[model samples]
Target chain A: MKLKNEQEQKVKAGRYGKNFGGQYVPETLMTELEKVNKVFNELKDDAAFKAELHELLNNYANRPSLLYYAKNMTEDLGGAKIYLKREDLNHTGAHKINNVIGQVLLAKHLGKKRLICETGAGQHGVATATIATLMGMECEVFMGEEDTKRQRLNVYRMNLLGAKVKAVTTGSRVLKDAVNAALQDWASRSEDTFYVMGSAVGPAPFPEMVKHFQSVISKESKKQLQEQAGRLPDMVVACVGGGSNAIGSFAAYIQDPTVKLVGVEAAGKGVQTDKTAATIERGTVGIFHGMKSMFMQNEDGQINPVYSISAGLDYPGVGPEHAALAECNRAQYVGITDDEAVAAFDYIAKEEGIVAAIESCHAVAYVQKIAPTMAKDQIIICTLSGRGDKDVASIAKYKGVQIDE
Target chain B: MSNLAQIFKNQKVFIPFIVADDPDFETTVKNITALAKGGADIVELGIPFSDPVADGAVIQQADLRAFEAGVTTQTVFEIVAAARKETDVPLVFLTYLNIVFKYGYARFLKKCQQLGVSGLVIPDLPYENRDEIVPLAAKYDVDIIPLITPTSGQRIQKIAKAASGFIYVVSSVGITGERDSFFAGLSNLVAEIKEYTDVPTAIGFGIHTAQQAAEMAKIADGVIIGSAIVDIVAKEKTNAPQALEKYTQEICTALRTKVEQ
Candidate 1:
């Protein structure tokens, strides 16, 4: 009887709270997921793995990314002080390297010879390709045909890094379709390849695994904030696409009820318009892409083709953990329009001399709203998850100024 | 006895799978009647999903065509209701979990009972997560048909022990597709599964030809053919019902011929 109850409990082990994230995959991959889950559980706490991973982070990816006071914007807002967790300073120019380094090591430990990745705006693709080159593993990336057309430079970077990039033209030919293509590839190649998910979405262990690797962002920033400001910030803000960076930014402070966590989702034009990717705001509870979460799908459960000016934040769903966080009222999610995000993208670069990724600018846009309302003593730490170098050309195009390809 | 028990009463079963409303509703009902005329012991109706990650290019295209025709969940249910008037072969739905989930488990299962859909082949709904739907499925007299793959290993006993109707034994290492070869030790895998349950097992994925069907029939109690039929539907779009029936006849005739030998 005890064994039976334990087995039943095991079925619910990978879930977040009560309603999100189970291994909703084919039977062949279910066994493989179980194997990966078991390995991840063991290595997440192992001292040898930690030492090796820290060595790579410190030496290769240039760990301990800066926590800078955005003094110009802080004074201009004339209300709360603002600090930026500058993940943009990482070697790969994004927080994605943190998760990539960890998954690559885990895959290597499992004797995986090849790596698969799916990318939207291509920061994650570049990070995966960069690490695969460093680790001497074969790598392939699936990007949507539309994304490849926009983010051509990163395509070249992945190619230069010795990874094959395939343009997926299925579905709406965007991030979701790219994920679908990678999933199909992973389903077939689970024997010799490890799928390095770029975000905290997809099946279980992936959500937890990506968060575990990215928790470094919170761990560093929380300590740095304490040193600089003498206390935890009153609010933590990060942009949500598939929400890897947001989850990482919130992980360390989740237990502190006083620390308010906010996730800014990209609303392409406006939530009132059909063109929006604000999943947490307009989504219903449904399952897609291997995890049960809030999805912007039709009533019939067909996933909607979502839109966002920043390709990285264009997914129709948020991560399962984010869904649960919103459900249990641990985190509050809000939307930022494309216009607002673009204006903030320009403002952050001009004010702080920091070109934040358009995805991260959503958080900055939200800050431009609420930062002016709070008291001067309260602090807000916004995670600058990626540098805006890749998005500069697209931003120019969106502003009716085109540069040569 | 239920239609599921009736299918495996005496002979080796031949199952053919096709997406409902690939072209339109009237044609889907017609295709069902033709498949029954072609000696299908059971018919698996795929409820087309926008993202069919577990399927290869053929069925994926079929799903796209269904959506292009504006096929909705209600359209699929209506097609099944229309097909029921023409044939009484056990109807099973091959759907993703989200579709049934969005429709609500209780609501979807009640519809299944009403439509005479005896079983559900949800590829994503594994035995570990079966309890979420199994009790509901049982309440409505619907079998949540469980899948056991070549890689299931020791977990096969745990899954098979609770299975009803039949066990979908995936013959290959990956998603459903046409393959010239199957995973090694599939026969031994089937033998191992039989040690735990009285439920019949059907070998699916990659069995495209009559020769392949006869070969697979030697190992398992049933053989399921899908992608080949879906590919044919893609090839003969307007004439899919007749083409599907003729192809089903070929697969059925070969299985009986091999049995007589």
Candidate 2:
């Protein structure tokens, strides 16, 4: 496959279908980002690269996870049939590993010596650390100090994988600050460093690249659903942070107009309150983290400090593609409050015996509210993005269970 | 003559940047007068943004301090307008794109024009997306300055062609901070930009001390000192205006030295 020039790639990846994405980055990082884009463009069509990536995904990270039908929950709701796309069963215990493995392999192919990334819940950091350890590369992860405190086990997990986790204290001491710190690190050492962007956010190639890697989830679910349920699901749902899993789960179904896509955001207290990360519901168009996206910001254009029970969904900005999707009405984004998400966390554990991350519970919480309204023959597939083991301590504290960390 | 052209006409231009309302708006106003009196040809007044990804630690902290001091877009503009009453020094806003976008592009530029601001230096607004904000700036007679970095490669020519006022040549690969040494190809990068446009090219980022100013002035038409000046404001607190004036005087003196032919 012939690689297009940098300008052509920018046109395709920088904005949404018509407008919304572009590489609005400092000049120092442009060359490196463009280089990665060029290589990724060629490798996407290269059969050898595809074969190797598939081998790694299958043999290492365990692709084609089960599409389990939640019969009890479906029967209880008495409306839509609910199916869980069990991404929580993947290696590293999350859907994050899928994108990390692809980017880590691409970094190796590009001959980068170091891997750097920013994480909110430490899922992406742990996944990146796991891959970096396997690939023999130096790894550095920037995590918010607040997040490091909440997700302490994941921090230890990354450290155990031989990755250095730097706690960023600047700004609101959350995911966006971690992103700023990671970009600072990359700016000074971009020559030998590959920034493994954790989600479908940031500059041009990242949103497109991460979606390509995570599209595996929907690809497998599509085939699995057809075989198991004998038809396609009526609606697909996933939680949106920077929107990696949501975009991934919706990628295969985007062209299938019959399948309604829904993205649930973390509404910490409420969207009406300042403590929320429901960017699509409450945010306006602005540029942050190198992408033109819908962001929670002030009239002065400063990014507002956002809050959520799940550290993973505490980002002020949504991915540009999610913004574009929301704009086009292809995907409807709704907010789920923290209290509701906590209830869903417990409800899923009892009803289906499946423990989901607080982040994923946002999607489950939304499904619990809407499933009963649809017809019984209709089906809804939600991406259970990660395991709840990492959130047990936080959830215990939230529920007043008093577990000592 | 336009304020930018006049500032660059006679000698090697020396511009000092300071975040407005660092300690307070009054101190920022005092610093602007001090900077102009200290022989600064132009002054880059930065409006504090919540996230300044293009800057290093020094300026980032300064932004925090300004925000803590209750600096808003309106306050920064009011400070600049106050400074305009005291001096004729060309003032250019060194801010992020989001600030301008939030303030409304045309409105912001019009305010800049009303307050006698000479230009704008938005680090994130690269050449590719200049169309979003440049036309409004041009309408308001505010120069949207272009930046050329060491890795800009062939894009320097394209950026330089559209350059207004002058070109900002970033001397290092990273965000703004003081450095002991710079990229070896900086002179070559400046020369490449020169071939495409006759606009005065001013080198910035990591330019500290009188000797560094003199070294950069040899290759470019001017020099911009930011973090070094911001560092002073961060340390001196209430006395920042007087201290920054002394520092700017020494750097400007060195910048004016003629290169040996």
Candidate 3:
């Protein structure tokens, strides 16, 4: 199959286009977003800003995370060699810190005094809180009431990091609602607050900016895989909630047609079931949260309340870039059910001794299925976007085991 | 001329916004008629969206109440159509972009045109990116009203030039809600908007009480009060029409006082 050049595809998919993305935001927010976009554009070229960000990523965030060859799983799959990009080892235990660190630095440079963000499973919340505490900025996190209950430990962790966590009870009481609450908060306080969007979603600059910050994952993995595996991987896999980690992992390799980009989505029960977060797999083009992306919405354009075993992957919409990627057929998206993800989580724990986040397990689940179909020499690199510590309680409860924390 | 044009031509306009089917569709129709009878020059009817990022808690709750009451885009259009039979008050829809896009932009605007709905205030569709819906709106002769905020700065002129019906001047740098005071530079913002076009400019966002409405009327062609009226609807529930009418009359009275002065 012929593939459109990644750069050409990006040009065609301008900030907001018919099928992909656009800034569908209120006029009041345009000025604030534009101001952030201005500084962000300058910081992209400013040597000092670049150096500071690099130094911070290297020293503080502990970059150059390992590319561990999962030999046991590779042997078990009996088809392709599997490599795990250990974003789980990053500071704050997830890939979320990469974007958070970049955004927090940008916020400080822009003279923003307060930081606000929304999170689903609390990884982004924890990362933002960690960076905000480090920067001595006032930080607030909006979390859905349902997510707060599921990710209680991370909520406490955020509080311990000196960030106030506000429980949002509106709408579906999930990532989308938290995002709405955070946007509302930003709308009211945009003058003094920097809304550090958690995912590669939202309007212009945000999808681009978050992807840029996260591209570091792919950049590092590309070099590391060349050294570790002696060649670029055949497939790059990551889970897609709002698609930050997947986009981050796929960013560098999108231009390389040889490398197959695979995105895994949560198919709660099944794509046919009402409960699913498989946006790219089962969604139509629509506008929500300031971006025209593929969303699991009703015919009336109202976003559906999606379900997933992993709170982090329980969003109805995917990032605009992911939508564009899917549209251009540069990448393939697959849905993995909750049972499949949980089984993969357990299998990876036993076979690889790595307790993966339930979100990442979706990707791992797809890898297990697809790796068995590929040749032994072919390599698959999956991003373990975060550690599983935050999900242990929920996983335990899923198995009907009570943990008294 | 559109009802909006005629409404803005004569005197200071008092535009009141309410989420259609907040308590119920019948109550919405009654409240809209009440608003018209209470001296509203233009009635801004909101189509409840599941996510309203530009609205604060008050309007958000109103949206939720409407949703729980089983309001849909079709229901809102029907309510407006029903109200049109009873009153000639210019009706404008205040909703998010997704609502219209999902309803099919052409079809939605056509329905608005067919029903005598004069304008649309889609907060999410900024001037730079309105091409998707603007031409269709023009075809339907439904004014796609533009909004200018204090932060708009130089963009005000560009927005004001293309603006139709009336320019909604956001009083402060925030979402809709009652505020004790507006941005200190609001007067200058209004003055800047006037520099480009003669389109009637109305100030909204954070205008609650009659006093605030009266104060805003001093600087612009009109005043829009949303959350305050929604708050009344939220509080009074099924018995909201009387209170909404009374509150609408009070603010209208104040706005007219400014006009008379």
Angstrom error of the Cα, residue B17, model 2: value is 0.5
Q: What lDDT, from 0 to 1, does candidate 3 have?
A: 0.90
What are the clash counts of all predictions, listed in order?
Answer: 0, 3, 2
Candidate 1: clashing pairs of residues: none
Candidate 3: residue A349 lDDT (0-100): 98
lDDT of 1 at B215: 89
Candidate 2 iRMSD, 1 decimal: 1.0
Q: Give the top-scoring candidate (DockQ).
A: 3
| lDDT per residue (tens digit) for residues A1-405 in model 1 | 432343244245767755687778888788778888989989989999999999999999988998999999999999899999999989888999999999999899899999999999999999999999998999999999999988988899999999999999888988999999998898787889999999999988798899999999999999999999899999999999999999999989987878999999999999868899999999999988778899999999989999999889999998988998888788999999999999999999999999999999999999999999999999999999999999888889999997886
For A1-405, candidate 2 gives per-residue lDDT tens digits of 111232244446466744677778887887788888988888976899899899989999988788999999999888899999999999999999999988988898889999999999999999999999999999999999999999999999999999999999999888999999999899888889999999899988898899989999999999999999889899999999999999999989987879999999999999899889999999999988888989999989988999999999999998888998888788899999999999999999999999999999999999999999999999999889999999999999988898777
The DockQ value obtained for model 1 is: 0.77
Task: Compose the digit string of candidate 2's lDDT tens values, residues B163-190.
Answer: 8888899999889999999999988998
Error of 2 at A346 (Å): 0.9
TM-score of each: 0.97, 0.97, 0.97
A309, model 1: CA deviation in Å? 0.7
Cα lDDT for residue B199, candidate 3: 89
Q: lDDT of candidate 2 vs native?
A: 0.90
lDDT of 2 at B181: 91
